[model samples]
Target: MSAPGNPGAPGLAGNSGSPSDRAAQGRAARKRVPRSAHAGWVPSLDRPDPVAVLERQGRDRLPELLPIRYGRMSASPFAFLRGAAAVMATDLAARPHTGLTVQLCGDAHLLNFGLYASPERALLFDLNDFDETFPGPFEWDVKRLAASVVVAARENGHSETKAHRAAVEATAAYRTSMRRLSRLGELAVWYERLDADTLLPLVRSTRHRRRAQSTLTRARRRTSLQALGKLTEVVDGRRRIIQDPPLLEPAGVPDMAALRKIFSDYRSTLSEERRLLLDRYRFVDAARKVVGVGSVGTRCFIVLLAGRDADDPLFLQIKEARKSVLEEHLPSGPYIHPGHRVVAGQRLLQAASDIFLGWMSGPQGRAYYWRQLRDMKGSAEVAGMSPTELTTYARLCGTALARAHARSGDRIAIAAYLGGGDTFDHAIAEFARSYAVQTTTDHTTLGAAIAAGVVTAAPEV
Candidate 1:
């Protein structure tokens, strides 16, 4: 591993690197990787089969749940894009990069940015998913976020021109935010975060304000108590998770002993104080839960625990973590356990993370990470937004993404490369438009595979 860069040293941003020198380096990078190079999406001639990649991922997951994964991906182009992060990673390998590295969200789609509660119990807006996070070129994340705007806008019945405009505005916001962060002190940039007070004022439209308020309300209501009441029942004399077919089901008695050992191992990953606090809660039950379009087949377990009494409840979700999709295209790190890699990446990138977040190895040597099941977590409903609202949402996501990148990447170099212009924004907009088409084609191909009986796809719930 390489030594960390000193933010105040020579050759660094916010330091002795003169404005002219930085801008000249930025301009020089354009010559090496011109803006036009990012105009469209062309699958490399030797690109691997998309279906084959999906099948390979499924090998480590539950065999019975593979059909559900396929069905979820086949639902729409947007859904397919979510499940095909590995496919995008392969395609992005062929693109021109500025060699500026950041701890990437790897799958920085619009839906991935959301509102979640900080340890202080205050709501903060930030990147909430890190399953595919890795250190890589900053622009890869921007490309993914920009394309998601276009794909989601299309799914919401917007015109292509409007969708393209939203994507452009998002990239513009990212550029502007990067420049803003570049001028701040390193400590200031590190401390900057988008909390509720800082965020509500950014929404100028009444529609967006109402939507944001409603989302926050819903998130607060999604506590462990609510989950306990809705997902469990007292059967005979013991409390157990209610069965719900393919989505949720009990882990059964045979696995409980081993699961208890796994849970104990996870507690050891926490600090002494956190582990002591956790000891107050006794494990009640655990059940497998199918979650998200892309992760429907992965082993996700929601464990129920009680502190003091039955009413005092806590829920921890343990999700299997495989190697990040970016690992294939980017340089590998020292970490071998993918779960530990996720926990480290998340802690480094976010302003604050879940207090219970930790990692452990499970039966059969699978890596898994655990965190609170719900901590005022909420997302925007893209299907129900106007074009103006969509654009505003896009800009907010861009801003949050920029803040994350600034905390971990060479912000001065990235800001200078982006410059105070719309050239890079327009290039990303064009790439979003082109990639949206490619995603649709890939979704169609998967649907054809299901129809041909080569892959079975269960009906979506």
Candidate 2:
């Protein structure tokens, strides 16, 4: 791994010597490190042991981290798989690479791609996770994504060939789109996005179309009012969050005295203009909520604000920021604060973002990014999608991923390296199939561990 403060290195394309210059420099240094220098990119599947690879990656902290909750393995093997990202990441890092670097969803499994409403009310399709986003080999994303396809396919009873084909189709789309992007000018590439409507035609199957439509409908309905209706309920004259046990624990309202002090500090984190604007809205309620599979244990809070009238409401989700998993694998610098990295990466990748998207360092030195809680947020039901529909969704994800990569790097050079061929497609397909098999074996290992009482897996909700 490249060390921080390494100078005299080539930078990412279009960096222009701004504050992003150092990040560009770091990416360049990483690229120059020969694949042999890093045991993480081993290509031979048969000789390379996946479990050993995972152990090596987590060797620094494996025993300490293993006792963390393994949620609901008995319900379905897939649930255990969802919580084993650290194990998978280690395994994945030991795989072959196409050597193309981009900002990656380090854990780009099938479930991570989704539809999010932009500030303009336009629903856009994109990668939804940034916790692991960083400059890394493009194949890392595909390997993780393809393995997920196989896992989902196994759960849905699809054949190995069918799952492999879907993963190939997705990989092909990414290659083709990147090649096409190479021919375009920088501004055009930066502006490119795969929106929901544009993706509908590619879906093809009637069953898939119906599922996509249903998800789109639900996402549109998740406006602020809808979120408020679903999440908040009045209890004994005070608005309290409806507790859903471990899934959605009630966090009780913030102590008025504590909030009054914290709000003042929070205000300082905002721009003077946003601070003044926020002053108009009085804080009404706050609650702790557990959300998502990987993020379940992280401290996440939902704050309710009122703007002088009972009808006027705004909801915000303040998720705790922890160190990125990428930090363990890569040498990140002081210039790269995780919160700022997330916000910056989101802006670089997403065509549009929530207007309120911003970050702050808390009183305890914790970092967090704030955004609207449920402003038209929605995601595709991977379990319900037909093979054809999955293919289309995968293509859309690939195209979007390519566009995001083009934003920070030299598309022309990267595309030239790709060379408009199926070499990458075939390689990714092979890797995906192999990795998928590995995921199943690992899932089974986790199940065995749970059954033997080696780990206490959480009960199904």
Candidate 3:
């Protein structure tokens, strides 16, 4: 709660500046990029076609999956926002920025942060998705997260005032946490994490704690044995993944052999100990499994493996990793493999990560990263949340994001820039409201395209 380490840590030798000095510098930045300037949102006249961008990102994806992606995205404004990261990237590029870089959760929507098992098997809350992770202006992530709160609140039938309050609380928490963390030693800042036990005190009521407890219990049950029981059955004395139509089906017979070869290639990327641990399990089967609104079209697979006995199982997901949506607008250093970019960015941003996390090159040189299918993972159901619950959740997310940024960003400078005030929070809340309208407009445009037969989308089941 207090800054993690010694507040009186020595300042740079022969320098009059200290943490307060850095804070003052941040305060000065308000003149250059006025806080209020961020409150406005408008699509540029030359903004790229949203539908066209969706099609372009899908060019290399399985043709059969495109309609499914479009279908999932068309379900709601929030759903559409998830799949429209590319569209948002173009718009954010046209906005004024403070030029502060941090490893970003390129698609930092409400659903993307969740509880996941760390290497030590502790349940920790942090950013859980990183396909779009990139190094860019820190506020871009904040803006996306804040807008998500507003969009989600509106979808949940909350009033505009409630939505604005949620966004404001989140931005305020982000600013305050950053200011607190700025006083910590770098190592102390890096070591902070939001473990389940550590988070319980933040819950204001017995009911909320019970709900969190229930979620944790449910997550703990989501193990490999449980997945095997649900997704596989003994067929002719062999274990095989069940076929569930377009959602889950076996890959081509020819691709199975290629999968085995790449699975081995993936193993080489792990540590010696993990490779030994992994060797106990042999590849059993793999099936193309559609996942998430934005990732539906990508090459995502749930792989099954057997350990010393058939009863001992492991499930790993091999998901295609592509260049981040932010890459085109804000150039960063080149990455030879998109999978490495995702893996590296994830490691840099997450407080703790999966022990099995690794990347490999699949057939046709497509890049993919592999991790446990579902190890203590759960997300908040924003639609069912009360205003107070939503605000608390937003604050938690904001605090987690600040910790993530502090690990890789210039925390002192950023904290200084934010200062100890409500100015940035108020600006971000206004931005959230304006952007929520813009998201609605974009969602409507996609719906119109589908209605006009200009774009193809399957019916949501």
Q: Highest lDDT, which number?
A: 1
lDDT of 2: 0.63
RMSD of 3: 5.6
Candidate 3 lDDT over 113-161, as tens digits, reads 9998887888899999999988777888999999999999998889999
TM-score of each: 0.93, 0.83, 0.93
Output the better candidate (2/3) by lDDT: 3
The all-Cα superposition gives candidate 1 an RMSD in Å to the true structure of 3.9
Candidate 2 per-residue C-alpha lDDT over 125-240 given as tens digits, one digit per residue, 9 for 90 to 100: 88777766666665566667766776676677778788778877887787788778766766787777768877667666776677778888888898778877887788888765
- Per-residue error for 8 in candidate 1, Å, reads 25
**What is the clash count of model 2?**
0
Clashing pairs in 3: 23-416, 26-416, 26-417
Please say which candidate is ahead in lDDT: 1 or 2: 1
**Candidate 3: worst-modelled 10 consecutive residues by lDDT:** 1-10
